[model samples]
Target: MTDLILCGCGGKMGAAVRELASAREDCRIVAGVDLACQNSGLHFPVYRALSEVNEAADCIIDFSHPSTLPSILNYCRTHPGTSAILCTTGYSEEQTADIRDAAEELPLFYSRNMSLGINLLIELAKKAEAVLGDAFDVEILEMHHNQKVDAPSGTALMIADAVNEVRENNMKYAYDRHSQRKKREKNEIGMHSVRGGTIVGEHQIIFAGRHEMITLSHSAQSKELFASGAVNAALFMKGKGPGLYSMSDLI
Candidate 1:
């Protein structure tokens, strides 16, 4: 059985993971790290700081804010054999680099979206990019709950990156176009974000050609899809060597 420590235990995603892991026989939550660790309702010990936890876990599942990255990375650095699954989004470029560096010390899994369907979308996007090429203009649109702070949800970027990787000329992401009064650039990938109501998540990729278009979309009905994906990733990552992994790796 994989011993797990859950970061951001008080949040919705964290709580979902906690509930699901508790039901599974392959893993058990040994402890949790969260600043607001009041009445967590979990049987495991909960601590405000990672340093306060004395028990060692095989892996840590972090659905916390990007601000907590440093502490998580430090925990992995100090602990020789622990692995981690980072499900948080909106990380700066530097923070992403830190994750890559930390991966050299211990196994680390990172994904913008944990839903298996979304990861499949990423692969489909890559295949579409290769087949469509520069004959089509790519546009990515994403919508999330109003409470979400990040624009162009990380999943949108993940899809865009997949498309860009297979393109002859790498596409540049354009988030805003109000100021520019020019025709659409051939190598530009337009990214649009919508925030309203209680949207769980939705991402659509449009490939516009001369007279035809292809649209690929994925709509999340519940947060459990992501939560369960994280649990699966945590289980898959147990006892792995020092390296960075993604949903693609798990699949």
Candidate 2:
């Protein structure tokens, strides 16, 4: 059984994971670290600080804020052998670089979306981009709840990565339109965002050819799909090599 230490064990995402760990017996939720300093009703003890988690854990799955990236990376650096999963998004350029740096030290699984279905879409999208020619204009359309602050969700970016890898690597991320004078580029990826009333999430990738168009979509009816995917990642990563991996790697 693997020992799991969950970070951000108070928020909604954390709450869902907590429920999951409590229901499972193969792995023990030894400790929970959070800023709000929550006291969990689960069997394990909750600590306000990461340093207080004296137990040597097999993995630390972080679903916390991006603000904690530096500290989380530092902790993984000092611990040497402790594994980590980064579930936070909306990072700055430097923060993304920091994640790469941390990857050199610890086994890291960082993903914007932990949905396996979406990762499979990434694989399919990349293949489609190669098979479909320049005649097809690539576009990614995504929708989330109005509460979402990020314009382009991480899942949308994943899809962009998929398309960019196969094409001439000429995909542009356009969140909005400029003026009527604006002319779309040959390999530009038109990314559109839609916000609505409590939408779980929706992402669609369209490859438009002259007479026909192909679209690939993954819809999340509930957030549990992501939580389940994360769990599967944690279990899959039990004895893997030390390096940074994405949900696409799991798929």
Candidate 3:
């Protein structure tokens, strides 16, 4: 069985992970780290930081914010033979680089979206881009709950990047076209975001041609899908070497 220490245990995703892991036989949460420790109704002891946790964990599942990355890196450095599965988003370029660098020491799994369907959608979109080429115009729309701080969601960017990879990275992202009155550029991919009440998650990729149009979409009905993915990643991290892994590696 995999012993896990859950980060951001008070958050919605963290709570989901906690519930799912509790019901499973392969893994169990040994500890939790969160700033708001008082509100965490976890059966396991919750610490304000990872450093205070004394339980031996085989892997860490972090659903926390990007700002908590430093402490996690430090934990990995100090504690050898422990792997981590990072499920958080909204990381900057420098922070992403840090993650890669730390991966040189221990196994780390990171992904923008953990849903299996979303990853499949990414692959399908790439195939569509290859077949359609420049003849079709690509646009991506993403919707999340109002509390989400990031616009366009990281999954939207992941989809755009996958499509652009097929075009030799020649396509540029156009976040807002309302600033100037001009026709849509052929070399740009449009990105749009919507924030409203209780939207678990929704991503739609539209490809418009002269006479034919194809749209690919993935909607997350609940947070359990992501929690399952994260737990599976943690199990996969066991008995692995140092490297930066993603959903591509697990699936």
Candidate 4:
């Protein structure tokens, strides 16, 4: 069985992962790290910090915030051969670099969205951009819960990057059109964000051609989709060596 140390165990995603892991026989959560650090009836111990944890785990599954990145990195640095699956988003450029630096030593799996469908959507968007070429206008729309701090969801940016890769990274992203009165540029990709209610997540890629429009979309019905993906990622990291892994590597 894959022994996992769940970070941010008090949060929604952490709870979801904890509940799902409890039902699976292939993996088990040995300990949890959360700021709250309350027992809350969890079988495993929850610590206010990762440094205080004594459980020896095969991998660390972090659904925590970006601020928790340092502790996770330090824990992995001290514990050689331990892997980590990071499921958080909205990391800055420097924090992203830290993740890469950690990956050079231990196995690390990271993704903006853990949903398999979202990764598939990215691939589909890339293929559409390749087939439609410059004749089509590309636009991305993303919706999230009101509690989300980031304007454009990271998944939307991921889709845009995938599409840009198809065009040799020549595409420019337009986040807002209200500041400009000029027409849309042929090489620009429009990005829009919506926040309301408890939306799990939604992303749509629009490709507008001369007379037809094609839209590729993915809707997350529940948090279980991501939780389960994290569990699977933990399992996939069991025998993995030092390297950076992604959904593309899992899927």
Per-candidate local distance difference test: 0.90, 0.80, 0.92, 0.92
Please, what are the lDDT tens digits per residue for candidate 1 over residues 1-251? 99999999988888899889878999999999889878546798889888888998988899889998998888888997888899999999999999998888778999999999999988888888888889999999999999999888989989988888787546799989998899999999999999999999999999999999999999999888999999999889987899999998999
Task: Please give, for residues 102-140, the per-residue lDDT of candidate 2 as tens digits.
Answer: 787678898888888888888888888888878899899
lDDT of 4 by residue, 1-251 (tens): 99999999998899899889989999999999998759879999999999999999989999888898888888888988788898988888899898898788878999989999999889889888999999999999999998888868889989998999999999999998999999999999999999999998999999999999999999999999999999999999988899999999998
Off by over 4 Å in 4: none
Error of 2 at 228 (Å): 1.8
Models 1 onward score TM values of 0.96, 0.91, 0.97, 0.96
Ranking by TM-score: 3, 4, 1, 2
The alpha-carbon RMSD values of the candidates against the true structure, listed in the order shown, are 1.2, 2.0, 1.1, 1.1
Instruction: State the local distance difference test value for candidate 1.
Output: 0.90
Query: Between which residue pairs do clashes occur in model 4?
Result: none
Q: Which stretches of candidate 2 lie over 4 Å from their true place?
A: 40-42, 178-180, 239-241
Please list all clashing residue pairs in model 3, or write none if there are none.
none
* RMSD after Cα superposition, model 2: 2.0
Task: Give one clash count per candidate, in the order shown.
Answer: 0, 0, 0, 0
* Candidate 3, 49-85: lDDT as tens digits: 8999999888999999999898888887787878889
Report RMSD for candidate 3. Answer: 1.1
